[model samples]
Target: MRKLRVAMIIPDNRDERRQYDRPEPEFGPAPAALLQGLQELPEIELHVLATTRRPMAAPAQLGERVHYHLLPAGRFAGLSGLYLPAVRALRQRIQALQPDVVHGQGTERYCALGAVFSRRPNLVTVHGNMRAIARLHRALPFTYLWVGARLESLAVRRAGGVVCLTRHTLREVQGLARRTWLLPNAVDPEFFRVKREPSQKPWLVCPANIVALKNHLRLIEALAPVAEKYGLTLVFAGGGDARDPYYQQFKARVAQHPWCRHEGFWHRRQLLEGLARATLVVLPSLEDNCPMALLEAMAAGVPVAAARVGGIPDVIEAEVTGVLFDPRDPADIRRHLQEMLERPDWREQMAAAARQRAAQYHTPQAVAAGHVAIYRELLQIPS
Candidate 1:
């Protein structure tokens, strides 16, 4: 049997993805790893297409079946130009390669345009907020969301299938199309093994970028009273342009408050160490789509205190696997944090459940198999 050509579409730069993309390679490897795993199947040929300003060197082949193509993303058309000449170039490449299926990663214009221009039986994956994320930027939030929605709809119309982080996320693009599938983000239990020992001063950890809608400021502010009264300490793990106005205010607040410390960004291994020692993990974001950090925390046997938004409600039960709070209300987050501290047995049990769930669902082999099944169904092949 011949292998079918499956291509994954990504933004101009792997390191410069937008809000849904997070401009960071480490946070979302949906492209880097997912495609690799699919290629491992002997009867499949996988390709990755990403936008780039200048030409980039191709990676050495992972397996005989996998290939990568880094096309140059050209200059914007004119004033306030976002469409690039490379988009057309990509269309040409897609025509020539003629992939059996194309998968999109982020909401970046290049990826959407490339896939639209490709005009193939494609898969568009929503990492988070395809339409709603624009609300975060006040200045041009309307334009951002409007254009993104229009583009996303066009891409979905062109694709044969859609993959989302959770079922609730479909509410954001309900009428956009049919054939949407649910697939949550998962963690490797081996890498993030749980270590539940008798806990001490309940330490709180959050591994997310300090940005607006991530709602970290309110989380910090909530910590003030908690620190003064309950005696709490927080460790933040991630970095961005801290000098940005929102982040600057957050930084100044952090400086004034002695209880919280921003420890920059840690690699996956180092982050595992932090989570293992943590009493609980807090994911207080205004919006999200099953992020990797939450899964890692759960796999590491650290209970979660997250906001009730996005695909979060899909994964976390109010007091089952973990606790849920109002994303907008840091006071709510503080309450959950304090509750976890007071009831060690309850929180630790939640952590154990989280670990068990992660190990069962989110392994590389298991996730790979699930994805390959999607591809096979597209190709009308048996597993």
Candidate 2:
């Protein structure tokens, strides 16, 4: 039997200019996890296509079986919905490779647009809800979000199949495509293998980037009273440009609270180390679609207190795997945090349950198997 070749498009923030110049190309967690999973499959060969802000060196092969190509953004990259240049660049690559199946990693970016442009048997994995994001960002400075939303709709309508990361997104993208599969995002097993040693003092960690949609400011305010009462140190991991207006405001607010600290960004190892010492993981996002941080926390055996929104409820069984709070109310955030702190036995139980959940569903091996099944079905191969 011949091995199947698959082309996957993933989103990344690697410095393309320096990628070939350096020994390695920096990849974020999502692509890293998926690549790890897909590479482990013995009968499959994989090609990855990603986009960069500007033109750089040409295509580069990462491993024996995995190939990566970088597409440079043209002058209209930011203004004309992200990934416009990717469509032309990726289509050329797809034509040359002519793989059995082409998969787009996310709907909100050039990956989907490029896959559609490839004009192959393309499958798109909807990462974030662009329509919802556009609605939230309509009044914000970024008007491209609205354009991205429109492009997202176009991509879905044109895709041969759609892979939805959560049931929430499945419902949102229903009727747009005939074949839609629900698959949760996978977490790296390294997070599960991390040895957690609880902090002596109460240490709370939020591992998301400092963005307006993350609702970091409100989370800080909610923690103020709790921090004063319990002397808790709240650490906000992940970083954003200091020039971003929302981040500037977030930094100003973090300054007001003596207990709050913005830890900027931590690479994977540092992030895992922080997660190991954390007493609890917190997420108060206004919008999300199965955050990787939540899964990583669960894999690390830490209790989570997060807002009950988006795909969060799918992974977290309220009071079972983690505590869910209302994102809108600071009181609710405080209430959930207090509950997680007050009940030591409950926290331990939730941690165990969360770890078990990560092992069963979110592991790379399991997720890869799911993708293989989907790809096989799409190709009409006998099971």
Candidate 3:
């Protein structure tokens, strides 16, 4: 059997290149894991093209089967000029590689939007609904959302298939793509694990980028009142650089609160450590699609208190596996937190249930197999 050439394009390589220096491992094992999983097909040749502004500390010779291409890009804030360059370079790279499929991850500024221009069987893995959130950029205005929705719709329409990280996002992209794949995100079982016993403290955590869509401000607002009533310590981790204006706004608000400890950012090990110490995780985002943060937190035996938006409800059940709260209403978050905190054993049961759910749904092996199956189906390769 001939090997299938695969080109995996990632746009958010700035953090992967360690440019921020803030230390959340910016881009973690996601790209690597994707390549690793695809390579497991044996008849697949995986080549990763990570395009970003910051240079990567990559090896001169990564491996025979694996190769990395770094395209120079301007700072993320000033990406307008680099878009044409990236699209041209990426198209040229795809031509040279002649991959059987062009797989793009997320709504990566360059990868998903730019790479979809290739007429090949492009597979876009959109983790969340950016169009819905683009409406909330504040700085970008409604015109931006209108333009973004058009482009994103076009991107979805052009792609041969789309792999939505959750069903919630799939529903949003309805009538756009010719084919949609319900491809959920995976977690490193080695890192995020099930707890043998419950921990002390009603510590709730939400680890996500300080983007507007994340609704960190709402989470902070909820915590202020929750802390007073529930005696909970809300720890905010995994921050963004100055580009994320929400971070500054959130910081200003958090400064007023004495109990909230914004840890800025932490990597995988440190994140797991925080999860280990916490009683529950809260991701009251306005949007989501199986956010890896929520999955990782759940896998670590920490229950989540997240919004019922996007694909989150796909992962968390209301009061069963984890709690759900309205993202916009801080008082609602506080109320949910109060109720969850009140039931100590209920929280424990939910965490245990979450761990079990992770075992069934978000494992690396299962995720890899699912992708392989989907690819085989897309190519119509006989079993």
Name the best candidate (by TM-score). Answer: 2
Worst 10 residues of 3 by lDDT: 20-29
User: Which one wins by TM-score: 1 or 2?
Assistant: 2
Model 1 clash pairs?
12-51, 17-23
Q: Which residue segments of model 3 deviate by more than 4 Å?
A: 15-29, 53-57, 60-64, 73-78, 136-147, 194-199, 241-246
lDDT digits (tens) for residues 192-302 of candidate 3: 544434456677777877778778888777667457766667778866777556778888887888778788777767787777777778887877777778888777888
What C-alpha lDDT values do all the predictions have? 0.70, 0.84, 0.71
TM-score of each model, in listed order: 0.87, 0.94, 0.87
For candidate 1, lDDT tens digit of each residue in 87-116?
Answer: 676777788888887767755465755665
Between candidates 2 and 3, name the one with more favorable lDDT: 2
Give the Cα error of residue 174 in candidate 2, in Å.
1.1
Q: Identify the leading candidate in terms of lDDT.
A: 2
Q: What tens-digit string does per-residue lDDT give for candidate 2 at 242-356? A: 8999999999998888899998888888898998899999999988888999999999999998889888899799999999999989999998899888888999899999999
The local lDDT score (0 to 100) that residue 275 gets in candidate 3 is 78
lDDT of 1 at 63: 57
Instruction: Tell me the deviation in Å of residue 375 in model 2.
Output: 0.9
Which run of 10 residues does model 2 get worst, by summed lDDT? 15-24
